[model samples]
Target: MASGKEKPLHSLIAGSTAGAVEAFVTYPAEFVKTRSQFGGQKESPFTIIRSTLASKGITGLYSGCTALVVGNAVKAGVRFVSYDHFKSMLADQQGKVSAPRSLLAGLGAGVMEAVFAVTPSETIKTKLIDDAKRPNPQYRGLVHGTISIVRKEGIRGIYRGLFPVVMRQGANSSVRFTTYTTLKQFVQGNARPGQTIPSSVTFGIGAIAGLVTVYTTMPLDVIKTRMQSLEARQLYRNSFHCAYRIFTEEGLFRFWAGTTPRLARLVMSGGIVFTIYEKIIAVIGGRE
Candidate 1:
């Protein structure tokens, strides 16, 4: 039973380790998503793709990789840790853990993660993802960019897109962790003693969960994107202002300016991350 906490601890470590590697692999898509949010007028896929390949070469795909690696690693760590804690809470509340318990656990983890990471996450993401073409110039690397933002904008500025980040990320994580547990159960239940579940099953579940997460929290994510990019006039005036600023100044419609692209990116990036993370776990567990 000593392995109990040790094993669960591994989930957090595995998730975070997997998050970092996954972020590096999909950085190009992330670069595309961020640039789209901040790129503004003529920020179409074709142009950004061409511009990046032309200016930065293949390495352009990994432009903001360092920040993404750190940010996503921390995010995944917190998410797994929080989920573990919350799952216990739900279990205690109900006197036992179950799939439904996992849902609540996932929900709590999502909300907590969002609350903790909202500002800094958005700030870093914004700073990293900000279009290199923008007239404003900053540092050369992730750390430099983050330090520059804090120095120039203050503590509050470092967490510029706090509001939407919480909403979108919270819901996304809630669904992700919850669905992961549920799917794991389904797989185990159906597996034979000497057999294992198919990778396709895990991938399918992760993809479905990702799609649901993207759609559920899409509007907030869209606002976060614009908020990070300073693409919205109201959101830009006082970057520290809360989401209410968007509601009051531009109306709610303004919050979802770039949801289409954001959703598309989430489908592939988040889905792939979820799928690959589980597959990695299986591989590490000695599954052939």
Candidate 2:
């Protein structure tokens, strides 16, 4: 059996592996979502894919994949480690974690991930994705973009939309873990004794949880995307100002600019991440 001290490390490893797989599989959808959030006429996912292929070839669909893969892996590691730690702290003598406790644990995980991994990596990824459309892109790729941002705008530039990212990510994890844990419990509670719930069922539960997360936190996501994607930092004063401008100038639909692509990416990502995480934890004899 896995020792208590080793459980957190196992969670981190499992979560990173799951995240890397999710990033690779959903990168194309992420590419389109980033482009859509950068403020243009609403384009269908197919149109975005076609245009990206025609203009920049298949490479365009994975413009900042390097940063995404690494960032997501780190983010997932932090999330799972922090979440498991918090959940354990919240557990009762019976070792049962309540829904509210799970939600709070997820919130803590999200904030940790945003501060350590999401902000800089996402900023770089957004820059690279934005550059894919330029006739003469300023940043050649991920490495060049990172260097340029630091040289021109300083370290602060790398975390431009930290507030909104934190809000979005916090809400994302809170809703995801709460809903997923609740659903999984419901499933397991109903299962026959000695019968394990299948991975496919876990994937479906995770997908539903992801949809809940996307809708609940989409406005914050839109704000974060715009703030991070802008070449000019002076465009909006802060997160509230950015949201106000978008709402005033672009209307309500703008808040959900990339819903389709985001929905597609997140639904699959959630399923893949949770399935792999649970499977690995089971394999390692870690507490679920």
Candidate 3:
């Protein structure tokens, strides 16, 4: 068993492993989701994936995966570490966190990850995906592309869509973590003394949490993607304007343009991430 001193570090390792696996496995769905949001919902997810593969080969499906993989790893690590920290702080005398406190802790984790990891990496990933769609792509690769964006627009460019990203992530984690915790507790309650919940049950709980989170936060997800897009400078002024334009110009339904792909990705991602995270935590003998 990991010592109390080692628990947070073990969580970091477990969360990073889970996040990287989820990102790599589900990135194609993410690509389609972003494209649908940015380009509108004209094409089906299948069509988008097929077209991208036909035009750009397998690499097209993985265009901005580098940024996402790295970002997700760091983001998940930070999220788990901060979540544990905040949850511990908010825990009662019995070391149990209430639902509201769990939600708040998750919010804090999400905001911390968004500020430190998600914004910059997602900006780069969105720009790379947008660039790949152009007739003449500007970015050469992940490292070079990041350098180009930073040189051209500085920190602001890398941190584009910060507001929407923060909102989306905060909502996402709060809902997801709270739902998961509640469900896990329910399952644990059903079990006999000292019996741990099964991995399958944990996966199902995570999947349900993901579904709840996606519908609640889809609008913010669309807004965040658009705000981070390369043409965002020319398209709108800020996050508010961007949302306004999306509402007035593209219609209300446009906010859910990529729901299908996002749904697919997040469902699998939730299951995979939670399963792996728990497995690794078990290996390190850390509490969930």
Question: Could you tell me which residue pairs clash in candidate 1?
Answer: 119-159
Q: Candidate 2: which pairs clash?
A: none
Residue range 124-241, candidate 1, lDDT tens digits? 7666656465555455777787777778678876666666677667677777666666666666667777665566666666666666776666566656766666445443653345
Candidate 1 C-alpha error for residue 10, in Å = 1.3
Q: List TM-score per model, in order.
A: 0.78, 0.95, 0.96
For residue 185, give model 1's deviation from the true position in Å. 3.2
Misplaced by over 4 Å in model 1 are 1-8, 92-100, 115-118, 230-265, 268-288
What is the Cα root-mean-square deviation between model 2 and the actual structure? 2.2
Worst 10 residues of 1 by lDDT: 1-10
Of candidate 3, the 10-residue stretch with the lowest lDDT total is 1-10
Candidate 3: residue 93 Cα off by (Å) = 2.0
How accurate locally, in lDDT, is each candidate? Answer: 0.63, 0.87, 0.89
Using TM-score as the measure, the top candidate is 3
Q: In model 3, what lDDT does residue 183 have?
A: 81
Q: For residues 110-158, what per-residue lDDT tens digits would candidate 3 score against the true structure? A: 9999999999999999999999988889998899999999999998999
